[model samples]
Target: MPSEQVLLKPRLAPMIWLTETSAPVCVEISDGLRRTLFRRMSSLISGSLVGLIIIAILLYRNPIPAFFAWAAVDTILVLFRFAVIGRLMRILRDPSLRRPRDTLVVDAFIAGSVLWCAQIGVGAFLCMSLGDPVLAVFGTMLSTGIVGAMCARNPGSPRMVKLQMVLIIVPYAAGAAMGPEPWLWPIVLIAPLYLWGTISINRELHIDYLKMLMAQQESSHLALHCSLTGLPNRSSFKARLKAAERNASVLFLDLDGFKAVNDQHGHPAGDALLTAVGERIRGCVPDPADVARLGGDEFAILVHADDERTIPAIATRLIAEVARPYALPTGLVVRVGLSIGIATRRDADNDPMLLLPEADQALYEAKRAGKGTYRWFQPANDADLSSQVRELRDMLPKAQTVREHGFEAGLSVTRA
Candidate 1:
């Protein structure tokens, strides 16, 4: 699956559920139905086994070859259904088999249900045609039990259950219309009503299950994301950083003079400033999900870049863009500067835990160089960074833009 789709599918679930859109159900819903059926597979199989044993004893004296053939087919189809389900579950567990979404795997499920359902109908029809009241009664009782069990168990996929119901009842009703028994003929008339009622019940149950699933998805989204900025929170960022262990770059950032804005105007102004900063950073990044708000006035970004210069270039742009003035809901406008630390993962940087610390140390270096300037993490410069910064400053012009030397122009608060 594509990474974007992985993020989007669950997010879209609630919208799909609430709207009752006529759009075709996607793979996620299909997989859930498969799992629901799997949970009830054991009980369904046990019931079938018991019914088969009883039917064998009931037919011991008559020895109808066609009935025996039908029983053999049913038994084989039961085994086939088990195999199909087992393979599908294994595919779900193994990530290697996840890509290129195979329709064959899901198709197997539909095919198996169709075969088993048709087999039950055929068995019922044969029993009715045998002209033995005892066998007919036994078959009818077994068929009714199987249908009811399926109705209860397979509501996760209503269409599948409905299809199975039709397959079973249609053939049985046909047999009722042709058989010698006048008492059983009423079944032919009652079949349509039975199917309609059961289908309606299945639809209701399926809707309830969907509502519950949507609630779970919404709660999970809330937990993983920041409530204020709608960016990934600290914990979620850590997990994604770990997933990108190789060839990763971390840009640790802090807003310069943010406390003064809070102390001068208030916390609400600070919050509005932070939200605007998040949106600006998100707009600049290649993937919006790469940005995170670790805490108040602190943010982090995970970048995938081909060359060493790409990381520094990104850091430079962030310093300029975030330094731009933010207009709040109130009439007041606020200005804040940004300090950035660039750290790239070397081949030796196998552990994800160390990247943040490395970036944080570099952030300290940038702050020391001059509040708005950026710095790359270099272990050798730690002991004497002040001297090196002075050396660089002496070589350049007294004033510089953020793009030229990561030193941005000053800003004054104004009325919007």
Candidate 2:
């Protein structure tokens, strides 16, 4: 079918000459480099054609016919080259084209034919033995060097590079071998050496590209994951929450006595405890749920659950699991409890910011009700606090800023 599709398909045998092993090349990287090389080569070819036209005018006694013919052919090729470059630029912007490789191959073959025609003209214009044979050797060397440089930039697939190099070089070599001069036959012998050198460069570049890809992958993984607990960090968690289903739920967990652990022991012990808690939370959650450490002693989980009962059940399990004792590196057994607040899409309007606040309010309620427990958000309970302040205002009409005063007084009363 399409050349892009063909390139993507698994190769029957992708032979690397040094290793004698088969491996699939990365299609995206290869195609991108090919487009870049095509642009460079096309510009170079157009410039060379203009130079050839100038030389033909100076060398030939009857140059008018040759000029017009060269002008016609060069104009067509230049227009076609621009069209291909435009298509490639569009592909770079939006990758929807079906057969980029096929387009490139067609252009390459046309370029090869042009080179063959130029070589034949040069051999006919001058004596075949004197000027033609020397031109043939020089042309072959220049073509080989250009192709090798282009191939170095795109060493993803050995087979594809080999094919493109063959298309460009074989025609020129054939022209040299079939020339009228018997001495020029030996020029074709250098073709194998040129191919071997190009292949060697391509193999080395391919190995380097593979190493770069692996390093990039490792860096990406480290960026998205927490260094301490190896869980998804806050940034990754929020991204997942944004893309999560509308029916998903979030559980916000804060350790009850984590600060005391840090005070009694040290920050290292606190970190160890947090790591253990993260592991327990991971074990308790199902595959569809993602656990993230949202800095310090706070953590979050995004659970895929459309059912009303699923949130509470998961939250309760998490609280129990997190409350379990953790054995530290120093052989010290420490206990900590979890205060969890759960908010579902039905309660939070499917907004993470709103969902988080709902969970936070519920978490405050859980801490007020006494830690080591979980709570679901209740809008009525929120309104009841304001109603209680209003009742205090009615009882004492002098209380103007009752909302702030009532909250402070409530905290004092709870402490007492």
Candidate 3:
């Protein structure tokens, strides 16, 4: 015969033991709360599974009330699982979303809301269905306020959680003492969950901020340093140019035979020659001046000066500096010339990049006139570029005069 004593009493004591022993243990590192929350979720699922097995075992004897309670909790567990799994997948899809502030807000909102709903809904269901009015009210008030407190004390703000818990639980506990029938329990539970959701949304705004900082740092380094020569690049040159005074002059120098060096000695020897040339140029520029490798085989120098005398002297010094022969790795003594273009800050804007093009044009003229020389963008040079149309008009008449002179010379030679 089955004992009525065993059937009448639920295994409430054993269930309590299972819940307590299996409760999550998370070591709170500075970021320990996240791990704790994760472990708590794991514990909840595992403990719920155990509870379900126990429910199945007890179903053979008067399973009505037990089945209803287990099914209600189980359904709530499924909903919580769905919410958590969705969030996990989203985080995996976007790794940036899992960073501290972003992750805390997101997980706290979705997971906190699901848990809050489960706690209250399950509590209310057990209360109404079991007909234990005292137990029902106790479960409802405790679970509802507990969820509120959990939301308040979540990852985003542990202090807020304490305040919220006190405000929420005090009223519920007071009402519980007077049969604990608080009309406001349901509304209080919703407030914290929704508030946390808003906090999570705010966290998303700062995700791009971290990304911007990383990009800015990378760009700053790239702009200031040469990619190949490991020297100050064009951006550094421009900054130095701006700091230069009015009396400072810019000297742009290019290796005259660099292309031939590259063509004859292969690129490896060319690169070595360029590096040696850069060191030699730096040696020539004054201590107060800035030296930079502006681009391939091109260097710019900005020297502070008292008068125009300094610019020509610096240009001469650069020519003498680069005129020395370079000893190749194969021990060949090869000589290369320098074509420098000189410009004063008074004559041009102190923009290294912009001044580079004008200086390059002057350097081209120097090379055309002869190798191993310097040129300046004087008023006459500007006039020469402006006189292209007049030069074209003079050319045909000059050629006709030369042809007539040649014919007259031929007739005189025949008479002789």
Instruction: Tell me how many clashing residue pairs each candidate has.
Output: 0, 0, 4
Clashing residue pairs in candidate 1 are none
Q: How accurate locally is residue 226 in candidate 1, as Cα lDDT from 0 to 100?
A: 92
Error of 1 at 17 (Å): 16
What would the TM-scores of all predictions be?
Answer: 0.76, 0.60, 0.40
Candidate maximizing lDDT: 1
Among all windows of 10 consecutive residues in model 1, the one with the lowest summed lDDT is 407-416
Best by TM-score: 1
Worst 10-residue stretch by lDDT in candidate 2?
12-21
Quote model 2's TM-score: 0.60
Q: How would you encode candidate 2's per-residue C-alpha lDDT over 129-228 as one tens digit per residue?
A: 2335444444444455546564675555555566656655666556666678776666578766787778788878867766666566568768888899
Error of 3 at 161 (Å): 26
Q: What's the best-to-worst order under lDDT? A: 1, 2, 3
Could you tell which candidate, 1 or 2, scores higher by lDDT? Answer: 1
Question: Could you tell which candidate, 2 or 3, scores higher by lDDT?
Answer: 2
Sequence-dependent TM-score of model 3: 0.40
Once superposed on the true structure, which residue ranges of model 2 sit more than 4 Å away at CA? 1-146, 162-193, 196-216, 347-350, 380-416
lDDT tens string, model 3, 1-416?
22222211113443222112122432222122222233345544544454354334434433677556655665566566656555654654565455443334333443444454444444344443444455444444444534433552344233333333444443333333344345434535554565555445323322333344446656776889776566688878888776666676667788887888788888888878878888888787778788888888888877778777877877888899898999978666677889988766674455534555667677878888797888886535767876976898889899999999999999999999
